[model samples]
Target: MARYPTITEIAQKLGISHSTVSRALNDHPRISSETKQRVQDLAQQLGYQVNSSAHAFNKGESKTIGVIVPDLSIHFFAKVVRGIQTVLDQHGYCTLLFDTSEKMESEANAVSKCIAHRVDGVLAAISMETTSFEHFLKLSKHEVPLVFYDRVANFIPVPKVISNDYQAAFDATMHLINSGCTQIAHITASINLNNSNNRLYGYLDALKSAGMEIDEELIHYYHLQPDSIDTFIENLLTSHPHLDGIFVFNDYAANYTVNVLQKLGKRVPNDVSVMGFSDEPVATHMTPRLSTMKQAGDKMGHLAAQKILAIIQKQEPMEDEKIVINPELILRESTR
Candidate 1:
């Protein structure tokens, strides 16, 4: 195995004390300019890299942030991670990314790893199966600052960066109503999730505001099952043949819903209009492209990163706070 060149090796080669070499490498004010140049030149020639762990140990900080996401495959989450990296990189901090794959057990293990790594801070989005928040609360005991984005625990007294899911869903449903869509259906995620629950409430409220009948059968609580979507749509069309509009919580599911609708001999925006959320890449890739609400994933990520950094730096206190990003409506061929 190739051994990494260290400052001791550099000092031995330059015939100087290791302390002088270290001071020169760090550009200490007491170090002379000539010594600094020679040390830097020799270090570069020898391919010597700074030991970040030792540097962090001396400073009593990790200089690293842990980011935990339920699913990295989702485009929105990937964009959020990119946004976080952009901010963290600017501040000379590195990221440790963890994907929980929507499993509570994986999320718990990721939290343990973050604590073991002694990260300066953490940013997380709870998984679908995360009903208990004990794992997240453990971070507080270790004095590790934590911030949440998107899927968050409402009871946790920490900063949260989130989209205005309720307003977005309400507006989407109201748009369908304005476009002459009566008897609209809604597809949402698990009830345990705060965002999905808010969206479901928004959909219901829109129908009530428009004086349309609120049919329980029209609302489907999707649980990450593709075949369930088909069953719901098939049963829905059979029970309510006049269904005209469908609002889904996500673009990927909306795309699947559209495919199912087509398979059932329904024409999008003609026989049935569809609206989706998050404006993911799948929205445009699907035939007859989807009309959706655009959640600012990158902006949310930036806010979460900033909040955690502030907390870590003691510029702000870690308390119960919410920073909300309002979503924009993106109209396309999927809806009238």
Candidate 2:
């Protein structure tokens, strides 16, 4: 087997000191451009690569950031990761990604691993089961900079990048009301999530603004069970036969709700209009394309990455602050 090339080998071939090769490879300002180029040329020719672990040990900096997401299968989170990579890659930092599968236990374990690895910083979107943030607090005790995005711990004193879920939900609900929907139901996610709670408030306020009665029965708090949606729709239809609209918190749930509505012989838009949030890909692929609020997942991720980087670089201090991105309402066949 061919052994991997080392910095010492590159230095020997270039007739330069290993220190010179190291500085040149790192693009240190003290290294002259001519020598740096020669060192780089020989290193590339020899298939030499920097041993990041060793370099991190020597410098006491990992140059790696930990990114924690509830679920990687979600398109919105996937886009957020892409946006994070776009920034981190340009700054010579790699990411250690953790998919917590929307479970609090997994999220806690991921945090432990990040701390064990001594990551330079962390960006996280809390899982649905994350009602308490004690696990996240461990990172702070270790002095690791953290930034939350999308799903967040509201009480945590750290930077958060989030969409204006309240405004988006309000606007989406108002759109349904303006389209002649007198009796509208709502489907929201786990009550533990701040975004979901904000969306619920927005939905409620929109109904109140329209002089409509707030019926507690008309609102369904979804708990990630598809079968529950079926039961909820069946009961909703029986209780309120004239239900004309639905505003859901996320696009996937909205798509599922639409399917359930169709199975119950209700025609979308004609009988009931449906609006979803996040504008995920599933929204467009449905039979009647879903009308939704476009939450900029990529932008949110970018902003979160920038915030963590700033804190890590000492350019800004980590504090309790929020950077909000307003969502855009996209009209489609799902709504009138």
Candidate 3:
């Protein structure tokens, strides 16, 4: 194995005292310019390198950031990861990423891993099943900063970045109404998730504002799973013949609705217009394409990264700070 030169070896090679070499390497104000230059020159000549671990140990920082999200395959999370890496990598910090698979247990374990790794900071998006946030307090008690983004925990008073879901959903509902859709139906999920709950409210408020009576049958709220979702879609479609518009919780469900409609001999837009949230990649691939709300995942991810970085550097206060991004509606073939 090749031997690497150390500070002591550089001192010996330069015929200087170890303390002088150390002071020169650290660029102490008391050290003369000539001595510092000589120490650097000798270090370069002897292939001597400073120990990063020792340097960080003296500064009481790990220089590593931990990131936790519910799922990575959901293109939205993937975009956010890119934004995080862009900023953290540029600052010479390492990123430790964890996926929760949308399970609260997995998210809790990820938090423990971050604490064990002694990360300087953390950026997280809580899982849909996450209601108890006691695990997050561990990072706070340890003095490691944590920032939440997108799917956040409102009970925790920490820095966060999220989009305006209520307004976005309202806009989507208004668009469906303007497109000549009456007797609309909304498909939603777990009320624990702010995004899901706000979306449901947005739809109801839009209908109420338009003098449409609130019908309990028009709203579908349940724990969504792929295998069982198809069966539910069929029942909703068959039972609600008057529903001319269907606003789905996400892009995946919207696509499923389109497929089920086609199989039931229903024409999209002509028979039933559809609106989906998040504008996922597959939205444009369907026969009539899909119209959706653009959630600006990249922007959300970038802001989260910036917030955590600010806390880590003490450039901004870490308490109760939040940044909200607005979402836009995208007109496409699925909606008239």
Candidate 4:
């Protein structure tokens, strides 16, 4: 590989010392304007670019932000990444992304790698099984500011950005009740997840508020597998017999459920009403559009980025601000 010219080479070409070249490139006020302009013009002509790696090595700040998500395949995480990039780009900062795919150890290892890279900060959505927070402290001790988003650590002192899960679930359940769904069932992800637990509570709360019995049989914990979901739903149908409504944890699962229900010779909304969360691409593109909760993934990502920046700049974050942006109920063909 061809080696690029160094600052010393550029200085030699411009008939100046390396220190003068450094000051000129960095726009130091002590350097005369004419000298700085002359050096800059020469450096540009030589195709000079500062070696950021070397600069970071000396300064100990990479000017890079590391972002970790559960999985990039999920539409919601992808939307959040786009929003994070938008904000990071505006501030001349670069983003480094890591996908944990819901693995607890992967989440910890990703954070360790980010710290090793000397990143200025980190933005992470804690993994589904992340219970030990020792890995996070490694970053904190280095003074690398971290902002948790979507799924986060309740015990971590870092500021977090998340959708209003309780209210969103409450409103989604209420919608089912308003549709006259007396036997509503919920298909949700890991029961240990705060959002998942909150959604379950919301469903039960809605039932109580509507003067209905909270049946334990109506709750189903979903494990991702074609056969598992099929059997679960089949058992649900066979056991409940009167189930009229279903709330899925996410659009991908909802899409799969729709397919499964069709195989069982049931029509959506007409035979059974359904609702999903995250409003993924499939939600709108499906034949019978899904009624779901809309989380502002992009907005949440942008806020997470901004919060990390504020913390890095030593600006006092709204200390008491635990931002919970409300989720919208997107009404469509899936519900009446």
Q: Which candidate ranks first by lDDT, i.e. highest?
A: 1
- Give one digit per residue, the lDDT tens place, for model 4 in 179-230: 8898998888875576777778888888888998977877878745556668
Cα misplacement distance, residue 243 of candidate 2 (Å): 0.5
Order the candidate numbers by TM-score, best to worst. 1, 4, 2, 3
Compared with the true structure, all predictions reach lDDT values of 0.94, 0.93, 0.85, 0.86
Give the per-residue Cα lDDT of candidate 4 at 322.
68
Candidate 3 segments exceeding 4 Å error: 1-54
TM agreement with the true structure for every prediction? 0.95, 0.90, 0.86, 0.90
Give RMSD (Å) of candidate 1 vs. truth: 1.8
Residue 52's lDDT within candidate 3 is 78
List clashing residue pairs in candidate 3.
none
Per residue, candidate 3 scores C-alpha lDDT tens digits across 1-336 of 988888888778878889999999999999999999999988888778888756886899888889998889888788888888888878878789999988999999999999998889999998888878899998989999999988778878998898788888888998999889988888886777878888888998898888888888777765657545567667767787777899998988888888888887888989899899888898888778899998888788778878888888889988987688888899899988
